[model samples]
Target chain A: MTIKRKILAAILALALPLASPVLASEQAVTFVQNNVSKVLQVLSDPALGDVQKGKLFSEVITQVTDVDVIARFVLGQYAATASTPEFERFARVFRGYALGVYQSELSRFGNEVLEVQSVQERKPGDSVVLTRISGGALSKKSRDVKWRVITIKGTPRVVDIEISGVWLSQHQRAEITGIITKNGGQISAATKMLCSQSKTCTVTG
Target chain B: MALAGCVHPPWRAKSDPLEPMNRAVFAFNTVADKTVLKPIAKTYQTITPKPARKGVRNFLDNLQSPVVFVNDVLQGKPKRAAKTLARFAINTTVGVGGILDVAKAAGIEKHYEDLGQTLAHHGVPSGPYLVLPLFGPSNVRDLAGLGTELAVSPLSFTRFKGKQTFGRVRLALNTMDRRVETLQEMKTIRKNTLDEYVSIRSYYQQLRKDAIADGVVDMDELPDFDLIE
Candidate 1:
C-alpha cells in the first residue's frame, strides 16, 4: 500500500475520534487539510461579499490557528516589556492583521494544488506537516510549505508557517519589532498602524 | 590605541588589515544594489517569463563550462575535467545549445569550479578578506583568480557585429538575472538580521569554507553567530 493508504489504515485501526489527545501524524494532517479546504472553498465562493468573506475566513482560521501564541512570538523581546493591557491590545490588532494576510493569500490560490506529503515530529509536542503547493498562477516552481503544529493540552493549533525555508512568524516578528522600535518603543502606535491597514478591522472590533 | 590592543571578533581574520576600506566599499556596493541593480532586476523579472529566465540561466552556465574545465584541469582533477567536458558536450548539443539542462536530466550532475577554488586546492591561503566594489566579497587570492578567469574566459574574446556592446549587455543581463533570483531572499535576510553587514560576513565566510571543502563539511558545524540563530 502507498504511505497515505498505510496511514489511513493505521488511523482506522486506532478508531480514535478526531479530537482525541493522541494526535498521530494523520490526525494533525487532517486538521490542516480540513481547514485549508474550507479556506479554499470560501475563497472560491462567488456570492459572498468581501466583508462577509473576511469574517468567515477569520472565524475559520482562528479555529485551527493559535493567534495568541503567534502574537506573542511576533512581539519578540517587546512582549516582556508590554503591560497587560498593551499586550492584549497588540494581540488583538495582530490577530486582525494576520487574518487579513490569510484572506489576501487565499485570493491567490486559484487552480493551485496543495498536497499533504507527510507529518513528522520535530520535538516532543510539536509536529510539522510538509505540504507541496504547485501550479499557482504566480508560481513557476512548486513551493514546499511546512506548517508547525503545536498541541497544547489536547488541541493541535498551527503556530507558524514556513515557505521557501523562511518562517512567516520570523518575518512578521522582524517587521512588527522594527515598527515598534522606530516609534520609540511604543507598541500602541504600531498596533494602531496594523489595525488601520488590516481588512479585519471592522470584524475585529 | 595600539593595533595589538584592539579587540576583533573571532570571525574577523588578522589578515584583514584593510577592513575599514573594505567596509566602505561594502557600503558603496549596498547603495549601488539599492539604487541601480535592484530596480533593473525588478524590471527584468517583470518583463521575462519564468521559463525564459531559466533558459537564460542555462545558456550562461553552458558558456562558463570552458572556464570550469580549465580550472578542473588546473586543480589536477582529471576525472572532474573529464566530467566537465562531457557535461559541456551533452548540454550544448542535446540540450539545444544549453537553453535547457538536459545533461542534468540525464543524471550528469553539475558542479562549479573556479580559479580561486583551484588555488585553494593547491595550498594557497586566502589572504585578507577583501570586499571588491560591485563584485562583493573576495580575498587577495580570489581577486587574482577572478582577474585570471576574466582573461581566460572564451566569451570575452567572442566577436559579434556589435561585439563590445554585446559583451557589456550580456554581463549586465547576467548580473541582473542573479540579482533577481535572490531578491526576495535577500529582502527577508535584510529585514530579519539585526546587522546586515556582520550577518552577511559570517554567512559568506561559512559558505566559502563549505565550497572549499567541496560541500563535504557538516552544515550544522559551520560558524554561527546571531545571523543564523
Candidate 2:
C-alpha cells in the first residue's frame, strides 16, 4: 500500500508474462538436452545388453514423450468416434510402435553428442528446440534435429520431432489414417494390421 | 458419431488403388536396392572423397538446371527461372563446369522446379499413386511429367563423342548419388515404420507436396502440438 510498493508490484505484474515464456523456453531446451544425453548414455553403456538398453530407451521415451497426445493426433478423426477402451488399446499399441521407432533412430547415433543450439517459443507453453548431433560416431557431418516440446500442468513433454525436414508424427498420421481409410474405415482392422506388421506390439481382442 | 457428413481428409485423397501390383514392384525395388545399388553406393562412398562426391552432385544438379528453368517458366515463376539461368551460367564457368556451386556461395540459393510441379500448379490432379520398378514411388501426373521432361530436355539431343556412353555414365552416377545420400534415412525408415510400403508412400507424397508448393508447408495440414492439459 505504500507508493513504492504499489509501483513495484505493477512492474512485477508487467514483467511476469514476458519472463514466463523465456523461462518456459529455457526449460524446454533443458528438458530435451537432458533426455538426449540420457538416451546417448544408455546407447553407449558397454555393460548393458541389447534388451537392457531397449528397456532403458523405452523408459526415457515414455518419460519425455506425450504418447497420448501423439496417439490421438495420429489416429486423426477416428479418435473422436472410438470407445474409450478401443482408443486405449490403440494408444497402447501406438506407444510400443513409437518406442521402437525412437529406439531404432537413437541407436543409430550411438556415439554422437547432441548439443542444444537454440529454442523458439511458439506459444505460452510450447517451444521448438533445435539441436545438432555431431562428433564421435558421426565422422563426416553433423545432423540437425528439431524437437517440439510442450508443457502440460508444469511438466514438459515432447510432442513431435523433425529429422531431415520430415516430421515423424506427421508422417505417422498420414500413414496410419491412410491405413484406416484403406481398411474401409475400420479402426480395429487398422489396429490389427499395424500391430501385426510392427511386431513390437501385442494385439488384444 | 454421425456418418453422414464425414469425409476423407485431403491428404487421404492420395490413394494407392494398385496396392498389390505396387507392393510387388516395391519388393523388387527393395531387393535391387539391397543387393546391387546399395553395395555400389556404399563402395562409392567409401572410396570417393567427400569433395569429389559433392562435385559430382553439383554437376548433376547443374545438368538439370535447364529443365528446372523451363519448368520454373512454365509455372509462372520468372524470378526462379532467372535464378536458374544465373546459376547455370555462373556454375558452368567459375565453378569449373558445375563441379562447385559458386552461385550458391554468391547467395543465389538453389530451388527445384520440375514439370510435375508445373502440372500441379496448373491444377492437374495427382492420380492414384503408382510404384515404378527401380524408379520408386510416383503418381500418374508426375510419371507423365517425367516422360515430357525426358523428351524436351536438350541433353537428350546433344551430340558429342561417346554420347551414348556419357549418358549411361551420367544416369549411373545420379542413381548412385541419390542412394548414397539416402542410405541412413532409408535404413531408419525401414527399421522404424510399421509397414515399409505405407511409410514410403506417405513420405513420398508429403515430399512431393512440399516440392510442388516450393517448400512452403501447409500449416493447416500439420497436427496441433499445443496440448496443455
Candidate 3:
C-alpha cells in the first residue's frame, strides 16, 4: 500500500472506534427516550383496557429490556449450576414477573411524562441515561429515573434501572437468591414461589 | 479499569463489616417477622378499615413531627422545619388529633427527618451496617441517631396518665403499621432475592442517603462520567 494510504488507514482505525462510543451513547439515549414515550402513551390511552395495556407493556419490555441477562444475574450462582432447561424455565417465568412488575408500577404513573434528561457513557458499550417523571398524581414534583443500557450485538438494551436510588436488577438478584437459598438451593422452589406470587407464570412440574 | 471492576462500591465494603453477626440477627428478625409480626400485621389489616388504617398512620406520623422538626432545624433546613411545625399544628387541631391528614389536603406534604439524617447532613460518615433484631437494617450512625431520638422523644416526656402504656402501645402499633404497609413488598422480596441481607442493606443505605439529601440525588455521589462534547 502507498505510504499516504497507510497513514490514512491508521487514523481511521483510531478515529472510528472513538466515534463509535459517542454514537452508541446517543443511540442509548434515543432508545430509552422512545421506549419511555411509548410506555407513557400505552399507560395514558383511555380506550385500551388493562389487558391490552399489559400486552403492550410486555411487548415493549421484551424488546427494550435484556430479560435474559437480568434473569441470569438475578439467579446469581444458580445461573451457572442449573440445568439448561431449568435455567430457561426460570428465565421464562422471570420475564412474566418482570412484565407484571413494570406494568403495575407504570400504571400508577399513567398521567406522568418521562423526559430524557442526560446521558453518560460509562464505557464503550455501557451508558446511563437519566430521565425525569413529573406531572402525575403520584409524582407531584419530579422523580429521577436512571436507566443502564448496554449494547449487545449492535443493539442497545436496558440492563438495569435505578428508580429512587434502588437498582431493580440488583434488588431482584437479592430477592431471587434469597428464595433459592431459603428453599435448600432448589431452583424449582424459587420458580414455584415466584409463579404463585406473580400469578403471571406457571411452574410446570 | 480492571482494578475498578473488581473493587466493590464504598457502601458495599465499608458499611458492612458486621456481615456475619448481622446475618444472624437478620435471620432471627426474619423468623420473628414470619411467626409473630407478619401475623399481627395481617390481622390488623384484615380488621382495620382503610380509613382507620390511614388515621392510625396519620396519628403516628403526627406524634413524630416534633422529632422531625427538631432534626430539620439541626440540619439547617428551615423550610422543612416550618412545614413540619405547620403539619403538626394543623393536624393536631383541625384534623381532630391527627386522625385525618388535613395538612396534606391543604398541600403541605409530610416528610421524615431524624437525628441520623441531621448527622449525615453535618458530614458524619455512616459507619458499619448492623441488622437489629426487630428493627431490620441500620448503620452505626443511624443507630446512634435512633438512640438520641429515643432519649429525647416527646412521647417519652409527655406528662399524662397511662403515658407508659401509651408508649408501649405506640411502639407495638408502629411496628405493626410498618409491617402491614410493607407486607406485600416483603413477601415479594422473600420469594425473590438471593441475599435478603445484602438487598436490605443496599436499600437502607440508598434510602438514608436520599433522605439526607431530601430526595435529591447528589450528582457527586453518582459514578463519575464524562459527557460527550
TM-score of chain A of each: 0.76, 0.91, 0.87
TM-scores for all predictions: 0.59, 0.74, 0.68
Give the C-alpha miss distance for residue A74 in model 3, angstroms: 8.8
lDDT string for model 2 (B29-130, tens) is 999999999999999999999999999999999999999999999988999999999999999999999999999989898888888889999999999899
Top DockQ: which candidate number? 2
For residue B206, model 2's alpha carbon misses the true position, in angstroms, by: 2.8
| Clashing residue pairs found in predicted model 1 | none
lDDT of 2 at A68: 88
DockQ of every candidate structure: 0.04, 0.22, 0.15
Query: How accurate locally is residue B19 in candidate 3, as Cα lDDT from 0 to 100?
Result: 70
Native interface contacts kept by each candidate, as a fraction: 0.00, 0.23, 0.23
Which CAPRI quality tier does the interface of model 1 achieve? Answer: incorrect
Residues A91-172 of candidate 3 have per-residue lDDT tens digits of 8888888776666555656678788888887788788888988886655677788888888778888877787767777667
Better-scoring candidate (TM-score), 2 or 3: 2
